[model samples]
Target: MAKQALGMIETVGLTSLVEAADAAIKAADVTMTGWDKIGSGLVCGFFVGDVAAVKAGIEAAAEAASQVGEVNSTLVIPRPHEELGQMGPWIS
Candidate 1:
């Protein structure tokens, strides 16, 4: 089985994060875990799937979100550490 990967897209506004989540869902076979508000108008969207899909999803998300608002940062962790799951629901 392929190891699951985690993808995150952080944006400067709720609308950007929402757009990122939508684009990620449509562009790849990943599952949207959930999103969180990071204060200072920053929001983050999370997703999980195979490494390639996660990477693809995040890339698509960032591109789509940048059109409407600021994309602060994006990350993809392939085969993330199991301990990370204990942090929150979005990690797994």
Candidate 2:
């Protein structure tokens, strides 16, 4: 199997994260790893798939989340190092 890429979208609210997750899932063949709440209403959604698919998913997620609330940032890491998985369940 191809090494999975990781995609993340951070937003200011749960609603925005929900929107982001929806768009990400619908836009590409990605699996949602999970989500995290950073307190102060900040939330983040994570997805994993092929590099191209992850990049596409992140783009769609950011756009969709921004429409509903504040999107802080988005990231796509192609073939992230295995050690990253130790950081949290969301990274895998």
Candidate 3:
């Protein structure tokens, strides 16, 4: 597998997460991995790609999500541990 970096963008709702994913993908060479719900109307969009691409993707996602709704958080994990990638939701 390629050396993938993981990006995550947390939004106030699933709708915002969807918009985040769309803009993120359009802005960078990244793939939407999946999503996780953290309750209380919080949802997170996951993406994986090259380190720089992941960073760019998450930045775009954050900006897009912030425009339509609230953005809870954003993160980019470059060269994430293999065990984390083995997690079910991280499989993409």
Off by over 4 Å in 1: none
Models 1 onward score TM values of 0.96, 0.95, 0.92
CA deviation > 4 Å runs, candidate 2? none
Compose the digit string of candidate 1's lDDT tens values, residues 17-87. 88888999999999999999999999989899999999999999999999999999999999999989988
Better of 1 and 2 by TM-score: 1
What are the lDDT scores of the predictions, listed in order?
0.92, 0.91, 0.88
RMSD to native, candidate 2 = 1.3
> Considering TM-score, where higher is better, how would the candidates rank from best to worst?
1, 2, 3
TM-score, predicted candidate 3 vs. hidden true structure: 0.92
Using TM-score as the yardstick, the better of models 2 and 3 is: 2
Looking at model 1, the pairs that clash are none
